[model samples]
Target: MSDPVTFALTVLALLLGAAVLTALFSGAKALTSVAHVPLVIACGLSALLAIFLVSKVAGADTPQFVSAPVTWFAAGKFAANFTIAVDPLSAMMLAMITFIATFIAVFSSGYMRGEHGEPDAGYVRYFAVMSLFVFCMCGLVLANNFLLLVGFWEGVGLCSYLLVGYYYDKPSAAAAARKAFLVTRLGDTGFLLGIMLLWKLGGWHTDLTALFDHIAKNPPPTEQITAACLLLFCGAVGKSAQFPLYVWLPDAMEGPTPVSALIHAATMVTAGVYLVARCAPLFALAPDAQAVVAWAGGITALLAAFIALAQTDLKRVLAYSTVSQLGFMFLALGTLGAVSPVFAVVAAMFHLFTHAFFKALLFLASGSVMHAMGNVIDMRRFGGLRTVMPTTHLTFLCGAAALAGLPLLSGFWSKDLVLESLQFGAHSGHPHAGSFYLLMLVAMLTAGLTAFYTFRAYFLTFWGPTVVPEEAGHHAHESPSVMTVPLIVLAAGALFVGIVAEPFTHWFSGFVGRTPSIGLAAKLAGAAEVAHHFNWGIAGVSTLLAVGGVALAYMAYGAGGPERVPVPLAGVFALSRNKLYVDEVYEGAFVKPAEWLAVMARVFDLLLDSVSRVIAAVPRLVGVAVRPIQNGLVQFYALSMALGLAVFLSFVVFRAGR
Candidate 1:
């Protein structure tokens, strides 16, 4: 096996083994106490392997490395196989995911084990499921074919369902799990159909390389390509939590905070963005699909930011922030039609890589706060934690700064790439340039909103006078070294990962651009838009917006602006606070109607069952009516026989006379 292949399989084995072993020993506290050891090792090994593969690929003659596929099944021209292929894009994802997961595992050990170092209930089960989720996610990223990808894709979703409902006894947790599963599956259906369409259109090849080759050789109609691409985007929309399908994500905070970090940052949500980036060839050919991507992402970004402005729950604020940030990624992707496919893919992926670090940091930081506060996360319930938990307060501030796109931070670099991409798209001479321009404006507005909400949450949680809720007694303090250490490491990532990657040098862009599919996408796009690597104007505008937002947030929350809303703006506050009633709209538009249909179907089924019962009674009624004739009496039988014989003789005489 090649290096990438060996590393991929080994990582999978380690995680799978850990999951099984931890599960078998869940009842044994002694055994379960050490479960996180294997997880940390496995995740850490994956991170190292990913970095190694990325470096090798960057210097290799080929853009990717693929191992010999092991065929699972075959019939004539169709076959499904297990294959591992690593490219710049997947490698980047691997590095980000596993890196964050390693820290998360370390943090979880401290988290699941109480602050006093005693193992909490279900500690072993938690690690077991967490390992399984990482395994599934790695498989999804390493998959070489659509068939294999979809398998791991569903596996990731299944693991997400389990993780989100970790507290199965809690009704909210269970319901949230179901909602996440069902909603994502709705998009997965479209994704599957799209895959099948592509298979048919691309000469029955499920291997991504072969499929792309076939499509390039014998191009499908533009409309067919567009339809397939759009269908695939449906899965992205749901998994990434955009618009109508986004309801599940906020509710998913009912799970453990670590689970939220994994789902929202590294694993489940990122899958959708990965899918779209992986299939750039198809989307590049479909301008209409690209436009749709851009529009959906822009609208989602703006809407989620607005909603974030009014949220009170600590994790819910970050949850909406994740939704909004994902919108930014999609917005970058939507610029595909207006710029080089390589440029757009790199821009979106760069953000994904950077986002994993800070988002995970913020969530884990929230976990730290929850630990200190006896699990009280509502900002309304707790205040003034800066002096109480100094370490957590400082690390959380780093994450918040990055998330707000402060200059020289991780988010600053990546978000500028996204905005720069959109700006290029606006003037790329494409027919949809006008629409792209509009999207860029929306994105600019969203940037300010992002900064505002992020800082607002920060100030509300940590800057006010000390007011710890009753849940947290006088003993509230910083998390232990096991937890805070990871926070510090991740805080470093949030602060420097982008600068180290060197956005100005175009190193990240060049490395990810070597991806074969990205090259193919560029060919399909034709006459690539020539855009600058750094645009000071766009950067300045975005920086100003971010700064302005931060200032506004400081004035509103930190500098003692009115605690209560102004009467004139109360209605707007209500709307934003209520998430613009999106859930209610969905209930009225889709849920209520489906529920009514279900009720009618149940009534119809009962009616049919009644009719069947009446028909079934006929045989019983006939048997009852003939009961007298069936009486077993010897004399009665003889009389009946004599009467029958006399009747027969009369009938015979009458026939003879006739």
Candidate 2:
């Protein structure tokens, strides 16, 4: 009902509707350069809407939900409503979705320039779907109730499937799309169950406010609460691409780079973090549930980080890195719920913000490289690119520094808060504190792994000798300004976020809480470790690990001095290049098992047929057996019928007769 909500929702509707209209009319322009105008305008407007919400109302109170119940279904004294809301959380997410969509839109202006062809149908289609994806994500985040959220979630998931397979003609893209959708569905099923369980809790309370109120009044059975948490986490694990559910993401690079950047890096994956943070109050009441969520999140983070250590493909490495960072956000939320619920939520939100910028920058920078280098992502095949693509190289370097948590980078500040959240966990009740300690240790291990892989990626792609393939010889150059502009903007964001993170943390603290303990320990630990060990502790260790990884790559590839790639590191390079066969393990464990099940489906069908055939024979056999009794004994049958009728009537009439 407020101005911000009305403006935001109206703009979203206008964007979507305008896009559809433009797409229809676009066919008349022979689908020329002008087709992009509508899309760019919509994206810009969307950004304006988001900024208005963020600047004017993100810190403001939640708006009362306004709904006109469109009858989705009516059955047996119940009706399903297509309800919507503009709460504080939804407003935040709405702003984020639109903002990222705008950046990606601007980047696409250059990245997808030559992609347009005769008829331009495909390009037009791309814009349409992209707009829908934004719409669905915004709608999902703003839904006041579970039913609406589920609908919106499914829409976003489907849009992701479409976007990931944007180059549908490519076998790789198609495969990746299928893989992503199927795996995510595994989690969505649980998400659906969680919704159902919530709906049924205390007699069909599906509205978020109503559900929370009921939970406050009559806390759910522990088993039900645990199941709800796990189910919701099923969606989280799949969306965030954590551990066993993570394989589809790296392969998703088969899509266009911008597609990968938008869906995997900037937007979709962070939905899980938003979900957990939104429900912090409910999770706070269930410590065991929180523990499960925290443990799963922590384990997932460590697994992905270790795997990232071995990757060689530039985008693939970043893909896994996204998964790992998301896991850290989850870990923070899951652990800090009871002790510092607000801090956990704020930290998670902040991490989500910083990660979006850096990760998207990383992907776009890689796109610039691929654009110049004949679509090659094999970092071992590149060298001395700083001279060739200065703008891109330098911008990417800044992005990497952010990702590696280097000082004064957005990643450093956000990542520090996440780490400190674990320490907060450690000082809770003794049992909780002990659990948090182990979790923090694992998270720290992930930090080391993060540095190792990020640097490995940087070194192979940027440093080392000039080993450009013959076809790629002397063709590399700076990308057009359109792409670099977004990269520079994002890089600046990444740099500035860290320096001002304290104030931002303070601002978000009003919604969550300012984390005094995390800041204390973070500063203390860094200073202490630096004083005790290297002149630089966390930063020093991280930089050294990164440099060491680069050095290792150099020895293994290059033959030239000071710029040598690794020749000896070739064989052992499989450790990093093959991602340590972790993807293979995932295929064997989950993928292969699913395949095996599919293979046995025919046998299962045959067994089912056998049972069905026997069931069919039973009815016939019973009918035949009874048919003999109905033969020509009519008088006898009539006598029996009369006797039965008399008894039946007597029993029925007894009370009336009396």
Candidate 2 lDDT score relative to the true structure: 0.71
List the candidate 2 regions with Cα displacement exceeding 4 Å.
58-72, 115-121, 470-473, 501-505, 511-573, 589-599, 603-658
Reference-based lDDT, each prediction:
0.88, 0.71
Model 2, residue 41: what's the lDDT?
Answer: 76
Model 2: lDDT of residue 145: 71
Error of 2 at 174 (Å): 1.3
TM-score of 1: 0.95
Cα deviation at 137, candidate 1, in Å, is 0.6
Predicted model with the maximum lDDT: 1
Model 1: lDDT equals: 0.88
Across 1-658, the per-residue lDDT of candidate 2 in tens digits comes to: 3466576677668677756866685466555555556666776787777667655554455434346556677687656676666555565567666766777777776776653223333666677777777777777777767777788788889988888888898888899899899989988888888777777764576667666667766777778776786778788878888766777788888877887788899888887777766665456655677787778778878877776766657888899899888888888877644345656666677788888888888999999888777778877667667778888878888888788776667887777777666776776662356788888778777776776677667666776565564445566678888788888887787778555645434544443232222322223212111101112344555455545544554454334323233588566545656766876887898779988898799789999999999999999999998987787988989998999999999998997888
